[model samples]
Target: MKNLLVTGYRMNELNIFDQKNKAIVYIKRAIAGRLAPLAEEGLEWVLTPGQFGVDLWACETVIDLKRERFPQLKLGIVTAYANPEEKWKEDKQNYYRNILKDADYYGAVSNRPYEGAWQFKARDELLFRKTDGILLFYDEEMGEASPKFVKERALKLADEEGYRYIAIGADEVQSMADEERLSSFD
Candidate 1:
């Protein structure tokens, strides 16, 4: 997709470079800030409402709007994260809920509700096999994961397993990555 929205929470822990939650927040925000220029060229990255949380964007719609505004614009959607608890959340979940509804393709980085609306398990597996890009969702932030470790592990797993993205809480990024437990999606 020409545009993408990457979403997740901040890692909870503060130590462990890989697991350092603050790092995750800084990095995600940095990425979004860097991508701001792309918005002018038909791509943009938008962070979620929560601080050090999920990274999302309004690219597809922007592209569509761009197209409507400037017919020559080309566009696509590439979602990077989703929550397993999405089906259960009440008020704050609507934005995510809408992402699922509007997404053209899922990142499949973790488990998600199949009955709600979008169900891409099979497609996710196929994508994973090809190592192209699969749906991604961060697991909960553990009390002791490191940030660098999280990025390292995620990079390794994504390389080996064909994941498009890995979701991590602001506090758990590094440590969680090092922990590398089986994602519920698996």
Candidate 2:
């Protein structure tokens, strides 16, 4: 796929409040592993909803891949609505701003700031239309997680429209961490 939408749980949903949590490294590695093959297969852009967790991590992963390996891979931050960080803490807002600064393209699906859940649905619709596939960092066991909504939408479209949807779950991330630890001894 040429364009891919990378999305997943928010920081609160993941219970990861601190940005420097060492666990983030493993998450990024898993994302990179998933994307590398896609990049080789002509994945040109990674689009994310710009949430504070996997979405921003995915952006960093894409940026790292662009700098170190796949120069053609680009990051796009498309939020559900404007002012996505308005209610966020100072540090979190700054982080979002920096991610936007590095983005190849940035926009809000809804021009206005968040009004209701409708904006999020609009975002999914817009992103699905623009992207050829989705890479979701979500687990079905997180039953009430925000990513579940996105996952449901992806599943519906995958069979009906032949869209691609890839999910990287806790097992995959744990494996990535294991791989990283094993490789460090080399």
Candidate 3:
């Protein structure tokens, strides 16, 4: 896929209140593991809805990939509405600002401040229309949060148009953590 939309749990949804949380390392590793091969196969762009957990981390992973391996990869952050970081703490806002500064493209789907849930639905439709595929960090049992909407929409689109969709489940993330632990002893 040329363009892929990546999204998942928000910080609050995942109960990760800070960037220094140890789980972030494994989460990012999972994203990078899946993304590297896609990049090798001509994935040029990674896009996110800027939900600020898995979404922002996915963009960060793309940046890491560009630095460490695939320089051809680009990052995009399109939020559902404007000023996505307005309510966030200063540190989180700064973190998001840095990502936006480094992004190849950054903007909002609605271009206005939050009005209602319809804005997010508009974002989902816009993402489905723009990207060729998706890399979602979601699982059915624990994915009753915002990611569910995106996942559901992506699955329907995949059924209709064969749109490529990859979901990273909790078990896969746990396995990556286990693999890292074992490799550290080697």
Candidate 4:
């Protein structure tokens, strides 16, 4: 069985509420569609950063998929440091806690407090080393600086490690929908 790492932009970066949350809907559908084949192809675990947007969405999707089809699928929430959400608002912290509670495994790459960018890099490298593949949701135009940097690093590491890399952006989602529509007429 293969383990997959998931990464992507946060809600604030995606302008999630701009289109009546259509972007979020698209992201969920796209991720689910991509994950279906992977699950069927022996995907056993999904590792996520436990962030508020793509990571959380992927974790939820994996949980749903486990209930609906892939019974053996498991989720792991990986953080850069212990209590990573310490500075977040109450609601955000609650959400993060709930996600960790629902996960099959949860741990931080660093046992100590977050030092700086190094901790984040360490976490990213740890995720890359632990998983067989990566599922990334990214868009260059989104202006999500951190996610974009992570995506680039993941891609580079994946290439070096021969790990499978799957990416879905807003354009890809639109293209997929267009392809489906075109296929319906065939």
RMSD of each: 12.4, 1.7, 1.3, 3.4
Off by over 4 Å in 1: 1-8, 11-29, 37-52, 56-83, 107-149, 154-186
Instruction: Rank the models by TM-score, top first.
Output: 3, 2, 4, 1
What ranges in model 4 sit over 4 Å off? 17-20, 174-186
Worst 10 residues of 3 by lDDT: 138-147
TM-score of model 4 vs. true structure: 0.85
Find the 10 residues in a row with the least total lDDT in model 1: 44-53
- Would you give me the overall lDDT of model 1? 0.38
Give TM per candidate. Answer: 0.33, 0.92, 0.95, 0.85
Evaluate all candidate structures by whole-model CA lDDT and list the values in order.
0.38, 0.89, 0.89, 0.82
The candidate with the higher lDDT, 1 or 2, is 2
lDDT of 3 by residue, 1-186 (tens): 899999999888888889999888989999998999999999998889988899989889999999999989999888889998999889999998998888999888888899999988888888889899999988787748878878888889889999998989988888988988899999
- Tens-digit lDDT string for candidate 1 (59-148): 333334444443433323332234543554464365455554543444543344344423333432333343332122343344333234
Candidates 2 and 4, the one with greater TM-score:
2
Number of the top-ranking candidate, with TM-score as the measure: 3
Over 43-154, each residue of candidate 4 has an lDDT whose tens digit, in order, gives 9889988877888888878888888998988899988888888998888778777777779999998889878988888888888888988899987875555677777777
What is candidate 4's local distance difference test score? 0.82
Task: Give Cα distance to truth, residue 46, candidate 3, Å.
Answer: 0.8
